[model samples]
Target: MAGTRVPTLQPSFDELSEPLRETTFVVVDLETTGGSARTERITEIGAVKVRGGQVLGEFATLVDPGRSIPPNITILTGITNAMVVGAPRIDSVLPSFLEFSRNCVLVAHNAGFDMGFLRAACQRLGLPWPAPRVIDTVRLARSALSKDEAPSVRLGALAPLLGATVRPDHRALTDARATVDVLHALFERLGAVGVQSMDELVHAQRRVSTAQRRKRHLAQGLPAAPGVYLFRGAKDEVLYVGTSKNLRQRVRSYFGRSEQRRRIRHMVTLAERVDHVVCAHSLEAQVREQRLIAAHQPRYNRRSKQPHRGWWVVLTSEAFPRLSVVPAQSPQLGRTANPLGPFWSRAAALEAVDALHSAVRIRRCTQRIRRHDPDGTACALAELGKCGAPCAGLESVTDYAAHVMQVTGMVAGSNDDVLTGLHQRVVQLGSAGRFDDAATARDRLAALASVLHRGQRLAALCGIAELVAARPDGSGGWEFSVIRHGRLAGAGVARRGVAPMPIVHLLQASAETVRPAAGPLPAASAEETSTILAWLDQPGTRLVSSTQPWSLPARAAGRWQPFVDAAAVARGSLSGADLRRHAVTG
Candidate 1:
C-alpha cells in the first residue's frame, strides 16, 4: 500500500478561484474607411474568443461599406476597394458577428473606436445593439505596466512586450489575436492587487497614484463600524471630515482602484494620517461629522463651515421699536428686542423687515430719539401714517408700546392681528385702483410670513431642554439620541429583546451638560438647530421625554391667498415690461 501511487487530482484552470479565469472574453478589431463612425464604415471585422488562455473560436469577414475606401485608409490598412467588391455588406455580416460574441465580455484596444463603429452600424439598420460588458486593453495595460517598461500603449507597440504570438500588421484578425494575448498578460499583472472578480478587474484599470497606493496602510487598522474619520496632513491639521456606516470600507475606498475627483486625490496624497471616533450608530456619526466640519472649517470640507455668517432679524430695543436686519455676530440680547433669524442672507433678512414695516406702524428712521422730545420732527413716514411718530410725540408712549407688542407677538408665533390689518389694507388699495400700493403691501406680508415660519420652527426646537428620541436602526434594533437645547448631547443603541434602561442611563451620564441660553429663543448655532430638527422629523422617531412646552400653530399668518396672488402677478408684469423695453432699445 505504501508503494502504490494514488491518483493525483489536478485543479483545472476553470476551477481556479479567480472569476476572470472563468470569464469568456471576445477580442474585436475593425478596419474602417475613416476616423469617425458617423461618416465612416467598417471595411473589415475580426474577433477572437478565448477563456483561461485558450482560444475557443475565431471570426473574420470583409464588409462592403457601399462607399469608396479613401486612399489614405487603403494605404494605412493595406486594404483596397477591389478586395471587398464581392464581400457581404456590414448589414449582412453584423448579425453573425454579434451572434458569435454573444454572452461574452468584449475586449478592444481603444475600445471607443471599434465599439462606436459597431454601434453605428446597428443604428443604421435599426437593429437592437447587443449591449455587452466591455474592457479597454489599452487602459488595462497602462495600469498594469509602467511607461519605462512599455513606452507606448498602442496595439503594435504592446504586442511584443506581452509576448503576443501574432504581430499586428494593420489586418483585423492579426490585431485581434495580438489583443487577446495582451489581455491575458494584463490579467496576470492584476493579480498583484487581488483582483479576483470581473468587477474588480474593471475597476482596477483606473490610474492610481503611487502615493495613494502606499498610504493604503492607513486604512488597515480602521474598524468596520459606524464612525467619523479625520484625514490629517503632515502638520496634523485636519484636511477632511467624513462619516460612514462602515468605517473601514469607506476609508479603504479612497485608496481603491476607481478614479476619484482630482481634488480628493490631491487631498489623499497630502494626508499623513487617518484617525477615527466610533459612534453608537450612523445617525450619531452624521451629526458628529457636521459638528466637526463646522468646528474645524477644514479645507476639503465645503459645507457647514460658516454657520455664523448668516443674518438675523431683530426688533431693536427703543421707546418705539423698529425691526432691523443685523449680522449673526451681533444677536439681540435679553430685554433688547427679540431675535429671529439665521436667514440665508442679509437680503432675505431686509425683505422680512420691510414686510413687517408694511404691516405695523413701526418707525423706520435710523435716528435715536428720546421719548416726547418736542424739538424732534416727524418724518414723511409718520405723515403717511406708516409710523406712530413717537419722535414727535404725535402718538403716545402707550399707543406705540401696544404696536411694538403686536410685532413681538407675531415673531413669537402667538398673534396674527397685524396680518389681518395688512390684508384689509391690501383689499382697500385694490378697490380704489391703487394696484401698486396693493402689490407692495402683499410683498411685505409674504416676507413677514416666511421669517415668522422659520423663527417658529427654530424656537420650538430650542424650547426643549432635554429631548430623547428613538428610531429604527434598520438592523432589527433601535437607535436613540439625546438633544440638549438644540445640540446633540449623546447617543446609544438598544437591541430588540434587551432592556433599554442601561443604555438610557449610560447616555444620560455621558450627555453634555449644556445650559439653556437665557431667553424664550434658542441660542444654538444655525447648523446645530437644523441638524436636530432634521433628526426629529425623521419617520418613526419617538419623543421619550422633554422639559419645555413646544408646539407650532396649525396655520401660519401668511396663508392669505388674495395678497400673495396679486403680489406675484405684479412682480411678473414688471419683469416682463422691463424685458420688452430692453428688447426695443437693443
Candidate 2:
C-alpha cells in the first residue's frame, strides 16, 4: 500500500481549479433557409442555457424568415412552410433570444455558421450585437481527444462517444443539446491536462498556437490607453511597430486565437519584449507611429517614409532663370528663389512646371543669355509663339522683368496670374472645338493646383516657429498640439476642469526645437507634416497661440477658377466687353 500510486482529481496550489463550475454557457443552434448568412434568413432558433451542470432555462422559437423556405432546407430541417405559418418573424423574436442568452458564453458545434446568421439578423434589424464570447466544441474536441478517442468531432459522432442523451437530427434544440454534452466531455478531458481556468478553457479551442500562448506574459505591463507599441527581438531591435487606442488589449490579442496571420505569428515567436509610448489622443498616437516607422525602418513595417527624399520644382538663379525639378536637399535652390514644391516625383514636378510654362512663359531653354547681347536664333517655343525669346534678344531685360515679377508673386502665395493665363488658353482651345486639347490644358491646371496647394499650406506652417492648437476630446477634455516648424513637437490633454493655457505654455516650453532646413519643407517629412495637417484640419479645432500668421494668401488658388468670361465680369478685371479679348495675356 505504501508503494501504490493514486491519482487525485483536485488541483494543487499552483493549478487553477473549478472554473467550469463558476462559468455559464448558452449552447445555441440555428436552422437557416440557406448556407450563406448574407442571402439567407433564419427559420428556427434553439438555445439551452446551463451553469454548473444544471439546466437554467431553454429558449426555442419558430422564426418566419420573411421568405419561402427552399425545398432542400425544409427537407433537411423538417420545418415546412405550413409548420412555420404562425411563427414570429426574426425581427419580432430577436429581442427575447438576446435577453435569454445575455452575458453567457455561446457554445456551438461550428460556431462561425451560427454566429454569422445571428450577426446578419442583428444588422438587418438595426440591433446592436452583444458580441459575446464563444466556444466551439469541434475545436475543443480536436484539442482534447485523440483520433482513436473520437473518429469525428461532429455532433452525431460525438453524441454517442460523449454519452449524450439527445440525438442530433439537424433540428435546432436537439443539435444544441448534443453540443452541450460534447462541450462538457471535452472540458473533462482538458481537466486531466490541468486546463481548468476559464481562460485556459478558451485557450484549449486550439486555434491559438502553443508558442503564442507562452508569450502572453509579455503583454502584462502594457497600459490600456492610446499608444504606439514596438515589438523587440532577443537582440533588442524593433521587429514590428503598431498603434492602438487600447494598447494592452491590442498587444494581448497577439497571443490569443483570433490573430492567425502567418507573418504576425512568426513575429510573435521572435518577439522577446514590447515597448509602448502612451499618447494624449488617437491623432497623436498615429503621428507617433509614422515617426517611429520612419525612424526605425523596421523590417515588418510596410512603406516607411524616407525623410528628405521628396522632389521639388525649383527656379534657378542664373542669368536666365529656368524651371527645373530637383530633390528637396538639392543645392541648386538660391536665397532669392523660393521652390514651388516638395513633389512626390521628378515627373510630377516637371508636369507642374510644364503647366506653369503653359500659363506664363518661364523660358524653357537651358542657355544663359546676357541682356541685349546674344545670338538672335529662335528656339522651338519662340517659333510656336509660346516664348518671349529672351535668349534670342527679341525680348528686352526690362520686358523679362514683368514675367519675373509675375512668377515671384505666384511663388509668394498667389495663383491669379497662372490661373488667368491658363484660362485664356483653355477657352481659346475650347472655342475652337479642340476639346481634347482643352482637356489637356485643364488637366495641367489641376496638377499644378494640387501640388502648389499643399506646398503653400506646408510652407506657411513651416514658417511658424511655434504654434499651439486645441480641440475638444468629446469627454469634457481638451486635446492640445504643439507644433514647431511644421512638426508635431509635443501633444497632451488637459482634462475636465483644468485650465489649458498653462498646459499649452508648458508643452510649448518642452516641445522639440525644430530648425528650418534649407529647402522648402523646412522640418518634418511630408508624411509627418501631412498627418499634422489632417489633425489641425478636423472640425472644432481652435488656435490657442502662434508665433507667425497661420493663413493662406488672398489670391490663393482654391477660391479661383479658370472661367475667363464669368470671372472677368465678377472680378471687374476687364473694363468692358470691347477689351475682353485683350484683357487676359498669354
Local distance difference test, per candidate?
0.77, 0.78
Per-residue lDDT over 81-123 for candidate 2, one digit per residue giving the tens place of the 0 to 100 score:
9988989999889989999999888998899999999999999
lDDT at 255, model 2: 77
**Runs in model 2 with CA error above 4 Å?**
1-26, 30-45, 50-56, 61-107, 111-151, 157-174, 181-214, 255-266, 334-336, 560-586
Candidate 1 Cα deviation (angstroms), residue 255? 5.1
> Which 10-residue window in model 2 sums to the lowest lDDT?
1-10
lDDT of 1 by residue, 1-586 (tens): 0001112233332233348878998999999999999999999999999988899999998999899999998999999999999999987899999999999999999999999999999999998998898999998888888889999999999999889888998899999999988888888877665555676677767888877776777886777677899999999999999999778767767875774788888899999999998787766787788778888888998887876567777778776667787777663643444576668888888877776777778888887777665457888888788887788877877888888887777766577788777667767776676666665666666566656666677777777778877887775667888887777788877866656667776777778787876643445677767777887888888877777666776544435444455455556666544432322110
Clash total of candidate 2: 0
Query: What are the TM-scores, per candidate, against the unseen true structure?
Result: 0.76, 0.74
